[model samples]
Target: MFNKILVANRGEIALRVIRAAREMGVKSVAVHSTADSDAMHVRMADESVCIGPPSSQQSYLSIPAIIAACEITGAEAIHPGYGFLSENAGFVQVIEDHGLTFIGPTAEHIRIMGDKITAKDTMKKLGVPCVPGSEGGVATLDEAKKLGAEIGYPVIIKATAGGGGKGMKVAQTAKDMERAFQTARAEGKSNFGNDEVYIEKYLTTPRHIEIQVFGDGKGRAVHLGERDCSLQRRHQKVFEEAPGPAISAEERARIGKVCADAMADISYIGAGTIEFLYENGEFYFIEMNTRLQVEHPVTEGIFGVDLVREQIRVASGLPMEFTQENLKINGHAIEVRLNAEKLPNFRPSPGRISQYHAPGGLGVRMDSALYDGYSIPPYYDSLIGKLIVHGRDRPEALARLGRALGELIIDGVDTTIPLFRALLEEEAVQTGAYNIHWLEHWLETNLGEA
Candidate 1:
């Protein structure tokens, strides 16, 4: 096991990694920007380093700075919690070249799965179902139009290197193809520095489901089941639940095994998520997140597993602690992201948190770095925290989430608490009947009332 590991991110996830390391008897090094001088992760870690200014490009995303921090602190490994350089293949190679273990998958896997077109092709070859689309990246508008026609109408154009809804456009007809292609290409180039884009058949009401799989880097792997992330806004997940309410036990087992078998085939190491779009009882591969996901806690709650510890153990050349037979879904878990944003508009609200309080009870967990008097810098993502609740069943989980959200409080900044409070009252949400587009449509029709 590594004696010390550097956490190369910020906010709640950074703290999450630090806590996990501490529990495993591993020293932690927290790297922070000037803006996060007083961040909780820094205060909690065994050692700390100031990487750069507040801007993420100069700080959290600085590969050189993080490597230097590891050298200075004698950290043996780096645990990129989620964002920033977590999925950067180049960064992983750099760390490996420097003889430092990256607590994630191999750089080769990251590179192959980072590109949308290559990822789809790989999954398709592995016998995982995929959405019909161009065989590879559509190089020209003419090619995009051809593929759109072949795939039928209501096709979507997506940046090969994109995520979080960026560099994506939906075209309902051939007339919309040109604009969609151009826009997707431009956004991809501007955001990810890649102009590559691909086309896929867009299902209007598909549910977004993802399977969580873990591998020991030695061809041994297991699946922890699925998480229903269909509750989304503008293609970004807003709410997530474990053991998707809409899927049957048999279907869950089949998909979970498929994901695990795929990982085993590739000898994939560490934790990864294989995402799909489900409609009419069919699952189509969308993408794979090669790192720990933001909503991983829900899976942990239901499966009673510590994913971060497993990730670290895998990186240290240890086999997974359990097999598929040892894993069993115990209950339903729900997670509501509490971002520093105003309800309805969802505009970013970053400032000093004058007051803060977290809900506590059986099966309720809050992952956050906020405290009274802590200033939330506007230089990063708006997610400030997450409230997770588990219950014996979905209905009980929903009820617990409502009580937990009501008990939580954050002052001096607009938050999405009101939005969640309203969502709890919706029958679709309560009964788990929502699709990926449900949240966006609900906001458009009910934001005024909310």
Candidate 2:
């Protein structure tokens, strides 16, 4: 096992990994920007390093700064929690060159899955179902139009390297094709620096379901089932739940095995998530996240496993602790992201925390880095914490979420607590009858542009 691992990101995710490392008797190194010198993760780690200024590119996203921090602190491996350089294939190669372990998938795997086009092709070749679309990137407007018309109307044009809802556009008809295609390409070039784009059949009313799979890089893998992340705004997931409400036990088993077997065939290492669009009892591969997910805790909640620890163990060449048979979903788990944003508009609200109170009770877990006086920097993500609750079933979990939200208190700055509190009263949320568009439509109907 690694004696010390450096957490290469910030906020709650860094704290999440540090907690797991502490439990496994491994020292942790927290690298922070000068702006985050007083952050909770830095204060908690066994050692902390100041990488650079407040700017993420010069600090958190700097490859050399992180590598230098690892060398200076003698951290044998680096755990990239979610964003920044977590899915950067070149960074993985750099880590390998320096003989430092990367606590995630291999560079080859990341490179393959990082680009949406290649990932879809790879999955299709592996017998995973995919939506009808282009075989590769379309290089011209004519080609895009041809594929869009062939795939039928209501097709989505997506950037080959896009994420977080950027560089994606939908054309509802042939007349909408040219404008949507041009906008998508322009967004792709500006946002991702890649003009490459692909076309796919967009599923109306499809649910965003993802299967979490872990592999040992030795032809063995297991799935931790699915998370329903359909509730979103601008393609960013806000609420997520494990044992997806729409997926039955039989459906879970079928998809879980398919995802696990696909990873096993590739000898994939560490943690990965195979995301899909599910509609009318069929699953279509969307893309694969090559690193740990933001909503991983809910999966952990239902499975009773520490995913961060498992990631470290696998990167250290240890055998998987659980097999396919050993894994079983224990209960339903739900997670809501508490963002530092004003209610109704969801605008960023960053500032000091005059008072901080975490919800406590059976089956409620709060993952945050906030304290009584910690001033949230305006440079980072708006998400301040994640509140997860587990119960024997979805209703109990929903009720517990409602109860816990009331107990939690984050003062001195506006938050999304009220949004969630209002969301609980809706029958659609209670019955889990909403699709991917449900939340957006609800936001418009009830709150308008939140």
TM-score list, all predictions = 0.99, 0.99
**Number of clashing pairs per prediction, in order:** 0, 0
Worst 10 residues of 1 by lDDT: 441-450
For residues 1-450, what per-residue lDDT tens digits would candidate 1 score against the true structure?
A: 999999999999999999999999999999999999999999999999999999998999999999999999999999999989999999999999999999999999999899999999999999899999988988998888888888999999999999989999999999999999999999999999999999999998999999999998888889999999998888889899998999999999899889999999999999999999999999999999999999999999999999999999889987889899989899999999999997667889999999999999999999999999999999999999999999999999999999999899899999999989999999999889999988888888988522
Global lDDT of model 2: 0.94
RMSD after Cα superposition, model 2: 0.8
RMSD of each: 1.1, 0.8
Give the per-residue lDDT digits (tens) of candidate 2, residues 282-396: 9999999989999999999999999999999999989999888988899899999999998688889999999999999999999999999999999999999999999999999
